[model samples]
Target: MKNVIFLIIFLFCLNSYSQEFKNITIIKSDKTEIKTLGTFVYEDDLIKGIKTKKNNLLISFQDVNKVFINKETYLVKNYKFKKYLFLKIINGNLSLYKDKKNYYLENNELGLKNIKKDEKRLQFVFKTGEVSLFINKCKAATNELYNKRKSLILSNLKKIINIYNTCDTSSKIQFADEVIKESNRPKEKVKFGLSFGLMKLKTDYNQPFSIEGSDKNFTFVGGKVYIFSNIFQEKLDANLSIDYFFRKNYQINDIDYYIKNSTQFTKLTIGANYTINNISKLITPYFGISGGLLLSSNSSVKLISKYLDLPSRHYTLSNELIYNINVGSYIYLLNQKIDLIFEYQPKINTKLSDSINLHNNSSSFSSLSFKLSYIF
Candidate 1:
């Protein structure tokens, strides 16, 4: 009875693990069907493939006539010995297709015949009666050939429009507009956001002078607004931000001498961030290094003069050039228009002045900040 119960539990776990993968159906050219239990995609080769628990399977582009995933069908179409996978039929005999190509380099170790590079291009297909037009990138083609391709595309598009007019003209205008918009949409290139949080000083000071009674932990409340531009489109970003910290006061006492001090720190940062641009995903993480100038000053100091009289004095700490490293993750919500970000940044100890230093007799300063940012 114990062995039977263990076997039943093992089977139950195996069934649950198998349910994690989606079912895929591949229809071959010979009218045979391959029913597989795994996720599949079109990778480097001109074929549709899947990685299964047992082994990887690659079906030739010519052999695969259709693929069915979750009741949705993808038709395999061939042009000039290259296969294109069309997702579904659009309005008035139009369809969306993905074109993939592999490029080989002459100096590559694998030789010129072996593919060393790959790219996927979005394509639109328009078909009417016996006419078909596939619109793709033609930047490298000659002007004459480019114009010819464009003319053919427009001509076929007109036929599709005429067919739509004869049928459902109610949705033609909206459908045509959607197709045009999708074809000409620009890629996302820039993002802007604002962040607010508290910054805490985490430096250990080897002070030449001592304060008899003082709080060692110094924290400042501040906010920053930043703009990020894609430097390498989806991989890296150039970041710029202006940070403003509110003024903070510290009271120091040294046995019969009392001092009142206040300070404000502002900085302008220029940095680069390596971002994983999975905007379509729920969470994205990034890390970066930045160098900036901290515009700082000591506002007013009240202390007892040598004559046993209290006096107020104003002094300035020189502007500081500092470097820092930051790590953060963005929680995307509401179609990525808004984000809740959590960040931890550690500032490297940089010298502020040759004379006076805040809290510490040493010239260097350091801070750790926790921030939350929203991006639109």
Candidate 2:
């Protein structure tokens, strides 16, 4: 829970305070162009830059020929008996457009038509025949794509739309070559992987200690999921991981196995990672910090003295959370589809200390770890 709060605060800081479009271009029906470098709000098919232009600043749907926001071009078109700003994505004899989350196709000869939106962005979520059948009005386009009926999806949806807009032989040949290159483009994806590492624990003793045989060194296993991101830049990302380990210490050369301490814990780590440089490179270095909960079968352990025959004593639950630092390098393989990772954590959490042990200023439990992971 602490980890979640920290992540939320970090993202909240990165996002801009407002969603305003500036330096946006607008073309009137009269063919006059205006470049409004001032901040403007767009909503309800109107550009609310209302100002001292004496009635020229407030822009309505009927007044625009086209509006440009960077490379995107939006035109005021009619949809469902109402005026709307639609982004034209493909232009040919038959044109394709997007209005918000929906897509519409239009042509002078053929009436406006809507395309069924099943945009999951999955690699192959839909079949070509499914889309071709939906837009059967374009027989030439369908016949050309009928051969690869099974490969149609959001990633290649543009290619199909481009082919439909141009039924000519030259355009068809051009799209065929373009589709091959599109396959290599990188996309935002969630990658899964596993990691195994060794944990090293240290104890700071202020005075003489009685209990012994605590396993200071142990191994832990974990799995991680990485979500590719461009939060601030291209290589920035966020990931989640879980790890489990067991540690115990006992007194030896005694009749009874006097256990000093025993703990089996599982932790959840939520964090962000930023690659040092371009991710396409052979060796990509990255660093991150994560904070999360520590769940243990036994947080406070009881110990009994054999020789003294004293009553059982219990340790206090100093802290119930965990956090760590991760610095790693990725060794890319098989065309960057796979990565072998090596990571080091200088600190897992401060002391993991409770108030009791810290109050007496006698003991401290701390750790540092190393891990190796395989991501594909």
> Highest lDDT among the candidates is held by which one?
2
Candidate 2 versus the native: TM-score? 0.41
- Model 2 segments more than 4 A misplaced: 1-187, 205-215, 250-259, 278-280, 299-306, 309-319, 335-363
lDDT of each: 0.50, 0.59
Off by over 4 Å in 1: 1-188, 203-205, 211-233, 255-259, 276-280, 298-315, 336-362
**Cα displacement (Å) at residue 122, model 2:** 46
- Per-residue lDDT, model 1, residue 148, is 36
Per-residue alpha-carbon lDDT of candidate 2 for residues 1-376, written as tens digits (9 for 90 to 100): 9999999987786554333435568788899987764344445533333222334455556677788878888777766665667777877666677755556667674456666544664543454434554345555555556545556544456676676666543322233333444455465578987878787766433232343423377688889898886454347778888887766553333253243556566778798877787566678888877777767535444444566655444454344566677777777676654433433333232222334434321334566777767786
Candidate 2 residue pairs that clash: 214-249, 318-354
* Residue 325 in candidate 2, Cα distance off native in Å: 1.8
* lDDT measured at residue 137 in model 1 versus the true structure, 0 to 100: 19
Task: Give all candidate RMSDs, comma-separated.
Answer: 15.6, 17.6
